[model samples]
Target chain A: MALPDQITFASSPALSRNVVDALRAMIASGAVGEGEHLKESELADALGVSRGPIREAFQQLENEGFIELRRHRGAFVTTLRRRDIEEVYSLRIALEQLAMERAATRITPAILARMNEVLDAMQHVSPDAPASEAVALDLDFHDLVYEAADHDRLMRSWRYIRSQVSFFLQVRNRSHPDFVSVGYAEHRQIRDVLVAGDPGRRPTRSSTTSGDALPAPRRSRERPGLIAASGRRDPA
Target chain B: MALPDQITFASSPALSRNVVDALRAMIASGAVGEGEHLKESELADALGVSRGPIREAFQQLENEGFIELRRHRGAFVTTLRRRDIEEVYSLRIALEQLAMERAATRITPAILARMNEVLDAMQHVSPDAPASEAVALDLDFHDLVYEAADHDRLMRSWRYIRSQVSFFLQVRNRSHPDFVSVGYAEHRQIRDVLVAGDPGRRPTRSSTTSGDALPAPRRSRERPGLIAASGRRDPA
Candidate 1:
């Protein structure tokens, strides 16, 4: 599978970043399964890098919550409990709403034009297109909003969360077809709202709480297990 | 220094987490300076552990964005650029505003009362009474708000950002008189609004075109060079 352009080599001053990106993609793409142990020697050999870079990359990945390192056992890809997923999406809604509010005014005509181009491209792509492609498009659209907000820190946080959520999307996309259209529509509406420069107004109620606003479950599918497990419970 | 009581440590499942917490405290308290390389062997030696747990802790810290690891150079505390601080605060406003909105419904009298108790504690302690104490109270108030919002993911993100901001606050606080009263008043107003459940009904102003509301500079000190160099030219 072709990797998304966004994951291309960043001129990060640190070499370990290159390793981090490689490993992150592997994990996000499900090549590295959830809870799979990450062995330094194996990864180092596979990537043709030294144990130093592998260890450094592991350090970076662990911080991003992509992996968990056990003291003596070693590192493993992180498993998100259902509540963890909900909490992530909920936070995404809050940040995206804020970005949309800021992007409304700041989105230049050029940015809007690019967004429209993405929408048009998405329209023609079959809903059956690889889930990664769909997820990449979704990210590109949101990245534009984040860029417009002019907040680097927010963008970084969003990037981290998006990486985690993309894992879940990979699973969900295998079964769901209509999310592409619904997601595209939400993007279009959000774009329209920004272009119109309406900051104070909430988007029409049709926008679902989930970023995608997927339709209700059909045929006892993956819906309940995923959504129920997405957020946190009260300690009580 | 007394660690906050909110975090309960369980010894059974995750030793890496314990190491992560210990290292985080070290970084947060300024025991580890920015740009200082973290050597696995050295840290292990200091903590009376092996390289395994230290390496595990490094992974956790890296994911949290607290440190950056270079291939052969080892790990160093992540440095914030001026833009990084601005982005952090901007995101804080967005996240905090959402928390405030959610807290409007979830906030209980008991939480409000606890917040008031903390505020009262601040009132009794003069601003001159140790910077650490004042900062503790400040954190307590914000923590209460996060608790009221009842979102664990948001709280975790908030805590991460707050820790980063604290580094800058250390520099800023030295120049400004402790504006404890003003800070408390703002919290009070926010609490009052939440208690009243005022929907903040003012139509969001045209989000697209409006510029940020720049607060009058409370301190005339020049922006830190560290941040100024890193600040992105905002497209807006």
Candidate 2:
């Protein structure tokens, strides 16, 4: 099978980052199976780099929860066995909601235009096209919202959170190409909210609870906020 | 000034983790100034350990965004400046709200009681108590919910998000002892919500926006949720 596209290894300066991305892309594309033990020497030989960069890449991946390093034992790709996809979806909602809120407060016409630009780009990436295109647009659309929020720590935190889903999303999209269109509609919904402008200054009915931004998840099929249907937990 | 207590150095076994906590405590206590370069060798000597552990500890801190590793230069503690506390508060709202929601669904009586146990322990930790006591309880209260949520990645991501506020929280408590009370009350509010149980299953007004669970930031002062006022942005 062909390697997953659009995950071109980044060049120079940060050599370990390239290895990290390449390895992550491999994991995403199912080039490497889950629960596989990743030997440093094997990866070093495969990537044709020294073990130092391989070790560093392993360190970076371990930090991101992509891999685990046991004492004396080498690194192994992390298994998300007990952690259900539902929890991941919920986190995406929480984080993206915060990002949307901040983006609403800080977003300008130019930024809104940029999101629409991505949306326009999304239309051209047909469902029959490579899932990477879908993944890239999906990542870009959500990323712009966080980027517009202008919070360094939030953005940094999102990057780590996104890593967990990057491969999973590609797999999901590849299998269900419908996610491309479905996800675009979700992105448009977010765009509509931001286009409505800063809700931070708008007065709303007072409530004493947190999560005031989201109504309770009354019905499961298609919750209204933050790409809900994209990842609803099928009744377990 | 005496190093603000509660940050004792840990002995071997997990030396790097111990170093991470000790260094974090130092940062929290202002022993290490923000933007100061941290020499691994100096830190090794000072902590009575070798450079290997110090390097590993520094890597950990850098991953948490506490320190920056320059290309040629060594590590520097990141200045939380330019980082608006308002953004930080909102992030806490997003993360903790989701954690609270999940914890509510699966929280055993055992965990709830454990939180109450911490709360009970907290009272003896008077406002007059070392700010560290308040800090520890504050950390414990929020941490239990994430832990109870039982999602490893969520918990891991929260830990990283938390490092940004930890030093700020300790310093905030040191200076504003009143926040200790303010924060406790807020934690109690969340406890009440969880005790009420199943807000996720409960019906509420439906909304399309991402933050439908959260009401608009009507006032900058305390609003309901997890500890609100403790981290409220000072009107600069």
Task: Encode model 1's per-residue lDDT on B52-120: one tens digit a residue.
Answer: 767767766765668875556668877655555556656776677667766778899999999899878
lDDT tens digits, residues A42-152, model 2?
A: 777677777777777887888776777776677876655323345555676667666766778788778788889998988777768887777778788778888887777
Off by over 4 Å in 1: A1-37, A42-50, A201-236, B1-85, B101-117, B147-150, B168-178, B188-236
lDDT of 1 by residue, A1-236 (tens): 22233333556566677888898888766677666778887777676667887877776686567887666777887765655665676677777766766677778888888888888877777867777788778777777888887665677777767776676676677678666776777777777777778755454334423545323234435454533433322222
Q: Please identify model 2 stretches exceeding 4 Å from their true place.
A: A1-11, A198-236, B1-10, B48-51, B180-185, B199-236
* Candidate 2 docking quality: incorrect, acceptable, medium or high: acceptable
Interface RMSD of 2: 1.8
lDDT of 1 at A71: 60
**Residue B82 error, candidate 1, Å:** 6.5
**On a 0 to 1 DockQ scale, where is model 2?**
0.44
